[model samples]
Target: MKEGPDIAQLGALIGDPARANMLTALMAGGALTASKLAAEAGVTVQTASSHLKKLESADLLIQRKQGRHRYFALADDDVGALLETMMGLAARRGLTRTRTGPKDPALRKARVCYNHLAGELGVALYDGLLASAMLDEVDGEPVLTEAGRERMMQFGIDLAALETQRRPLCRSCLDWSARRTHLAGSLGQTLLSRFESLGWARREAASRVVHFTERGETELLATFCRQDQNSHGNRSQRIMRDT
Candidate 1:
């Protein structure tokens, strides 16, 4: 007979409702205390702690101790990616039967994934970069091109300075809502920070939704239009019309 599935056990660990809710909350890359997670999962602190122990044992989460309190987050990007994939599959399978539309306009526009942008704006930005030959997918990571380096500089991203940071510069993160890849990594973090600094985007209170300012919308349209003109001459018009 065929071998029993290696990942079957792992799948079972994530299949629990409490564990799944905890994972979903942690997907935003925040270190949450057990009490906070308990509230998010609609369970008691003791119950949430029990589930968290199981998840931590499975290497799906990591716990850190600060003073006397313990904080939990996903083990790493790998865990986050797996969770995002599961969410996508669940959505496709009609698990979200009651919620069939965008619940928040800000989420439909742009939002944070841990430290990077996600949603339609993020997806479109990624596509624009690819079309301009600034980035490419290699394995599961995003590899920046020489042209990409120049383009990023033009956008006021200090790529040379970012290289010194001890983190992956470019990674392709699967977007839970868009079902496509958006930029993640140190570069992605920097871009998000820059946007926030410029007042282009702001995080919602107690939510993962990210709101774009009026200036942000204007800037985004202008930047996208310029990239489109450069990439397709007049063909960009046709592409947008088709979409």
Candidate 2:
């Protein structure tokens, strides 16, 4: 009689090759039809139905109806974060699939983790913010500093409106590809959207890959790199005044 959580059962559900593949596809932060999931798993629709049933019953997935088709996605941000952490653990342990594709490098460079940017560029963004003291840690959680708010506002992000949303303003997510921590939460999502709107980057069609144009990459680098943070003396001056 186990009184604790049933981790073994959850492991069994996610350990299957087909189910794991299907779940990975949903990491792109899009709802996918059962048929599409089946294709991703390379299994028959009937088999996919059985797998999806187990996942849904365990509350690992949620269903959505669009038009005449039913789509499935990860239950929430927690689930996505868990999966990403697991992937990072696997990579750290040298347990990875041998068959790699052309898009692998691109994905490692920049991709969407659930809904926010992740990978090398994502890690860079997180690093830049921290190096610039734009974010501070409070009770182990990341908090947006006053300087961060100013910078974000100057970049055209509506902080006042975004703060009104129910979602958190800042969170740290583990980036599996880069094996580092990247930003997540309402703020992270908005920043990625801002990049797209500014034509700095674009998510690839039907894939998690994010492609930054040459100019966009250069701009992103200039913005997030620590060397460039020196130009922003206001933030440092303000911090000095407070300290």
Candidate 3:
């Protein structure tokens, strides 16, 4: 017996075209109905249901029931993190699809990796937090600094409440587009949520892109300004280029 995890099995499960598409759709951090997921996968409802069963059986997805409707989401943040990393790997290897559109740039700028921000802006945010000493690495794992705690509270994020969640308070997720690390875990989710609530950004309908208004983008860049990363240019340049 191979006394190790079954990578081949997991790969086979996710390797299917329809299954991969369904999983990718769930990456937007929304629970999707089977029919909706079927549309995303370009497969029939029966096929989507069968695929969903396999995903759920493998624990890659978790089922949710609302009234008579059944919805499904990624099992947890770990699964999301894995998928994001795999995407980065795919991009790095030039294994990406040839299809291109305007949405590609938007997705590469600011999109949701599960429930938190990702892409160039996401990399920028992570860089900012580290540059400002708001987040630090203790031993090997990332940890929030005292300043980060105070800052989150001031920004209306309840750190104490976040700590009570099942997942860690802070963790770094690899951004697929940027090939760099970005925030994840409860704190990451809260930050994204706060951005939406404060009108700093809005998730596009049926898409993962999170578009920030002109003013909102300004404030966001100002809030997480990275003084040391001068070579990366400034907020104005990034927004102009992305838009």
Whose TM-score is greatest here?
Answer: 3
Tens-place lDDT digits, model 3, residues 1-243 = 778999999999999999999999999999999999999999999999999999999999999999999999999999999999999999999999889999998898899999999987787887777778888977755799998888879888988888888899989888877777789999999999999999999999899999988888788878875456454335424533653
Clashes of 3: 0
For each candidate, give its TM-score against the true structure.
0.83, 0.89, 0.93
What TM value does model 3 have?
0.93
User: What is candidate 2's lDDT per residue for 1-243, written digit by digit as tens?
Assistant: 869998999899999999999999999999999999999999999999999999999999999998998999999888888899999999999999999989998888889998899987887777778777888778867799998889889889899998898888899899897776789988999999999999999999899999999998778766754544353333423322331
Question: lDDT values of the candidates?
Answer: 0.76, 0.85, 0.87
Could you arrange the candidates by TM-score from highest to lowest? 3, 2, 1
Sorted by lDDT (best first), the order is 3, 2, 1
Native-referenced Cα lDDT, model 2: 0.85
| Poorest lDDT segment (10 consecutive residues) of candidate 2 | 234-243
Tell me the lDDT of model 3 at 101. 93
**Model 3 worst lDDT window (10 residues):** 231-240
Clashing pairs in 3: none
The residue-by-residue lDDT of candidate 1 on 1-243, one tens digit each, is 668766888988888888888888876668999999999899999999999999999888999999999999888767876776777677677777464356455565677787688876777667677777778778756799998898778878999888998777988877766677778888887888888888888888767778888889568545643564554324434432331
Task: Please tell me which predicted candidate would have the highest lDDT against the true structure.
Answer: 3
